[model samples]
Target: MSEKRDMSRSRKLFITDKLMRLLLVGAASTSVLVVCLIFLFLFREAGPFALNPGLGKLLDSQWIPVSFQEEHFGVGPLLAGSALVTALAMLVTVPISVLVSIYIAEIAHPTEREFLKPFIEILASIPSVVLGFFGLLVVAPLIKTTFGLSTGLTALTGALLLSLMAIPTIISLSEDALVSVPYALKNASLALGASHLQTIFRVTLPAALPGIVAAVMLGIGRVIGETMAVLMVTGNSAILTASPLSSVRTMTATIAAEMGEVPFGSVHYQALFWIGIILLVITFFLNIIAQRVLKKYGMMK
Candidate 1:
């Protein structure tokens, strides 16, 4: 009787553990389902825009959705503008953020690093609207004056603000990567007559390459998806141009700016959904690339 009772108790514990695991898996699967549902709905609505031949005009520099009367459905300009702004922001952000991360992780005194880290994280906690407001009031005017921009809002203005926003995330993630570098490896590099900087570049960074890549990818995703601040500062012109000083519109801005006014089932409304699809695709690719890079570099281990 005693042995039978013990076995029953053991089976109950096993069942409980399996049940918990099943619940966790179900939760994750449900979350993925929700995401897939969103993608499906976006595409369903965007089908008209995708099917329209006027998509060519939407890519054109001039976006007078009303002037032509016949209607136009161009997305190329918005897509290109968003890409350019995000690229510029990444250019400005990645180096500064990585360097800062290195300083905090590998060089700074513990007390000072601890004190500063939270402040950096606080930047991420700030709402997007506040950042947009800051850009409108402060950065936009500064850009107008310093660069002679006709309008305070331009691609450069948005890029600058977005770069600032990207910094906290990049710094936080890169610092974690730097911290994860094996101490023995650092010591070995130093023992071989390598200076701290050389050791960092040669040994520590390479080992943490995956995490750094992940950090940059995440930053790109943030910049590409950012709506409020970019909408406020990117001039929202929906015109494609090479000049950073000129006004531009990003995919996110187009949806945010136009969706409300566009009548339901209208071509323009469908086009906005297409823009969402594009944004989703861009983000998905970035994440997949980051994952592949991490795996290739053995960082996942």
Candidate 2:
């Protein structure tokens, strides 16, 4: 009787485990399906412009989609603007985030780490719109006054705000990666008479390099996708310029600022979808690269 009872209990547990596994698989599969569906929908809507966009139209500096004379769908300015802002944001964010991460992971006391971690997380939780408001009201004026510019709204303004948003993500992920470095490696470095700083730069950082790369890539993704803040502060200009101080319009800002006014199924509307496709592709690549780095580091299977 006892043997039969144990066997029955084991069988029930096995069935429960199998059910849970199936549920998990289903959830993952659903997520993948949803992503593919989104790609299909975007491509379907943007197909007309995306498939046969004229050479000059796509590469033109102007982006006047509402003009009565000629509706241009050039994305050169938008792409350039996105790239400029993202580059500046990454420049400001990556180094500071990595340094802060190293300090939190290796140098800070446990109490300091505890306080800092939550504070960084809180920064990450702040809404983008609020940051946009802050940028418009505060940072914009400061930049104008300090730089002696005619207006405060420029790619630099957007980059500054986006950097603020990207920093928390970079710091948190990078700190985790640094923390995950094996203690044995650190100990061995110390046994070889390496100083703490030396050990960190030579051994710990190298071990955590993959995670750091992932962190930077994810931060780039955050900066690239930001809309409200960039729209509010970038002056919404579609000018093609390499200067960070110039007013610019990012792809995200373009979509946010114009999507509502565009008639549904219009060429302008479809052009917006094309922009979405571009953004989706950029973000997808960033995620793929980050995942590859993580997998290489054994952080993912």
Candidate 3:
């Protein structure tokens, strides 16, 4: 009787596990299906434009889309603007995020960590629109006054806001990575007469480097995809310039600000969809690069 009962229980457990695995696979497949559908939709809308004669025009530096004379659809300015804003934002975000993570993970007391972690996470929950407004009304004016600029809505302004938006994600992920470093490693370092800082710099941080790098990459992803905040603060000027203090616009801002007003089935509409495809490709490659980095890190370890 006991042998028979054991066999039945094992069989039931195996069936349950198999069912769970199938359910998870179904869910993952559904997610992939949704992404494929989105890509297909964008491609369908933008295919003609991609092949159109304007492909040459799209490579130019200017972006004059609405004119009785002729319309230009160059993406150079938008791409440059995005690159500048994201690059500047990362420069600000990465150092501060890593330092904050270090403080939260290695230095803070338990009570302080409890308070700081929730507080920092709450920063991410604040809506982008609200942050945009804050940037417009508060930071922009402050920047303008400080720099004596003609207007506050500059790429620098946008980059600053984006960095603010990205910090929480980086800090949270990096803190988790730092905290996950094995206690044995730290103890061994201390036993070897290394100071706490030395142990953290030499042992703890290296062990957690992979996760920290992942956090920064994810933060870049977060900053790059932001729409409203950059839209409102970037002055929406399609200018090809590298100066962060000047006004510029991003691919996301272009799509967001003009998509609704653009005539359906028109070249302008197709251009917006094309921009969407570009963004999708950029993000896809970003994720791929992130995976590669993680894999390389794993191998190095």
Query: What are the TM-scores, per candidate, against the unseen true structure?
Result: 0.89, 0.90, 0.89
Q: What is the Å distance of residue 153 in model 2 from its true position?
A: 0.7
Which pairs of residues collide in model 3?
A: none
Backbone clash numbers for all candidates listed: 2, 0, 0
lDDT of 2 by residue, 118-228 (tens): 998888889999999999999999999999999999999999999999999999888889889989999999999999999999999989999999989999998999999
| Cand. 2 Cα-lDDT | 0.91
Cα-based lDDT for every prediction: 0.87, 0.91, 0.90
Candidate 3 residues lying further than 4 Å off, grouped into runs, are 1-25, 295-301
Model 1 per-residue lDDT tens digits across residues 1-301: 9999999999999999999999999998997899989988988887766566545645655555655556655777888899889999998999999989998998899999989899998899899889999999999999999987678899999999899899999999888888888899999999999999999888998888789989899899989999999999888887769889999998898889888898899877776787788889999999888878877866664
Off by over 4 Å in 2: 1-25, 50-56
Instruction: Put down candidate 3 lDDT per residue, 22-79, tens digits, no spaces.
Output: 9999998998899999999999998788677556767866888889998889888898
Between candidates 2 and 3, name the one with more favorable TM-score: 2
Model 1's alpha-carbon lDDT is 0.87
